[model samples]
Target: MQNEGEWEAVRLLSTAARLVRREVDNRLRELGLTQERVTVLRVLAGDGPMKRAELARRLRVTAQTLGTSLVTMTRQGLVGELPPAAEGGARRVVDISEHGRRMLGRADEIEQVGFSADIRPELRRELVSLIHDLEVHRAGASASL
Candidate 1:
């Protein structure tokens, strides 16, 4: 029972998200950073050191996916992992290195510049609000299934 208007809304949102993601990814690539790596850095910066499983949950990705992402980030020196305790050895915890904090600050600057240049300053708040609402609804819809 979907109408043309509904379908158009879906397409518009999908396309806009893809375009935004592509621009961000392209910019990060210039800095030798991947989307997942940037996300890892942001999460660590915000939350501090956390267990691998918890990180995977927060990122809404599989543990294996996170493992692979972390390997690349670790190689890039953006993050570091701590060894298990000699006692009840738990999973490796992750933390952003000092270098990562510097890079993240740089990334934020780049993102702000890109957004200002490409997106209308006036629509920025509404666009952010729309994306947030979509995510909240999507999560609720998924859980109801």
Candidate 2:
């Protein structure tokens, strides 16, 4: 016999995530930014300049995936690649552009207004913990593979 009213945890989480993504994306659209782009901008702004490979690790994405975004972002003037740190060396250092920072600031404003008090602090902490745990599990699984 099956339980009459079992909760579907994964389905609920997925739906909530989709809705939140939609809302955030819509808000970001006003600034000509997407969530992915905003994430890159935030990391660069917060961490300062670094190589693309290092950026990829910080972003939790593969080099090739980040490369595609970098190409478009560079062309769109949201990011820039600088000369090697050494005079006679070769390295790719990237940083967020002024325009990107402006957009990120706007995005921050939108996010602050849109979600500042929606979720309770306890629930938010639980969600964050859950996400961290999942990421750790995922990394361990990938390593095993």
- Index of the highest-lDDT prediction: 2
lDDT, residue 144, candidate 2: 100
TM-score of 1: 0.76
Instruction: Give the alpha carbon lDDT tens digit for every residue of 9-92 in model 2.
Output: 787787777888898889888777888899999999999999999999999899999999999899889999988755675478
Q: Per-residue CA lDDT of candidate 1, range 1-145, in tens?
A: 8654767777877777788888888998888886678888999999999999999999989999999988988888889997788887776899999988988987888787874357776677888898799899999999999
lDDT of each prediction vs. the true structure? 0.85, 0.87
TM-score of every model? 0.76, 0.85
List the candidate 1 regions with Cα displacement exceeding 4 Å: 1-7, 116-145
Candidate 2, residue 76: Cα displacement in angstroms equals 1.9
Worst 10 residues of 2 by lDDT: 1-10
Which prediction has the highest TM-score against the true structure?
A: 2
